[model samples]
Target: HEALADIEDELAGLEAQAMAEQQRMALKQALSELPERTQEIFRLNRIEGMTHAEVARHLEISDSSVQKHLSKALAYV
Candidate 1:
């Protein structure tokens, strides 16, 4: 029974990993459909762990613009 439980846990972990990969692929496809600037902003904020303000500062754009781009990206994804 202990061994069976261990196998079940391992299978659950594999299923979770597969789901994560599928989500990643879907996100990538959605991002590809967005404009280049929007994609960059989204990546910087979401993937690079930058806040909206930080992304704005780094890109030399207004914070509002960064928020707008993120909103658009979020809507698509």
Candidate 2:
């Protein structure tokens, strides 16, 4: 019984991992479909662990602009 329970738990973990991978792939596909600058701003903040302010500073844009880009990119995703 213990061994069977362990196997079931491992199988559940694998299934969760698979679902997460699918979500990740879908997100990447969505991002790829966004406009170039929108994709860049979204990736800088989401993928590179940058704050909206940091992204805005790096791109020389306003923080509100960065927020708008992020919102648009999330809509795409």
Candidate 3:
């Protein structure tokens, strides 16, 4: 019974992980559907760990523009 309980716990953990992965995939799909500039800014800020200022510097855009792009990208997702 103890072994069976351990297996059940592991299964529950696996199910949780699977659900989390599905959610991540869905989010990626939504992000992919964004506009090109929005996607680039989103990737730089969110996925590549860049700050808004850094993304603006790299993309040659203003910080406010970066923020707007991120906001629109988030809204679309």
Candidate 4:
């Protein structure tokens, strides 16, 4: 029973890894569909953990623009 439980745990870990890979691929495809600037904003805010204002400052854009881009990116995803 202990061996069986160990196998089950390993299988669960593998399944989780596969699911994570699939989701990563899906996200890549979705990002590809977005415009370059919007993609940058999305990456900054979502991946780099930047705030809307921070992204706007980094890109030399307005906060509203950052929000708009993030909204568009989120909607696309």
Best by lDDT: 1
Candidate 3 per-residue lDDT, tens place, 1-77, comes to 99999999999999999999999999899988888899999999999999999999999999999999999988887
Candidates sorted by TM-score, best first = 4, 1, 2, 3
Clashing pairs in 1: none
Top candidate (TM-score) = 4
Better of 1 and 2 by TM-score: 1
As a TM-score, model 2 comes out at 0.92
CA RMSD (A), model 4:
0.6
Worst 10 residues of 3 by lDDT: 27-36
lDDT (10s digit) by residue, model 2, range 32-74: 9999999999889999999999999999999999999999998
In model 4, state the lDDT of residue 67. 93
lDDT of each: 0.97, 0.94, 0.94, 0.95
Model 1 stretches with alpha carbons more than 4 Å out: none
lDDT of 1: 0.97
Model 2 steric clash total = 0
Name the 10 consecutive residues with the lowest summed lDDT in model 2.
68-77
Worst lDDT window (10 residues) for model 1? Answer: 45-54
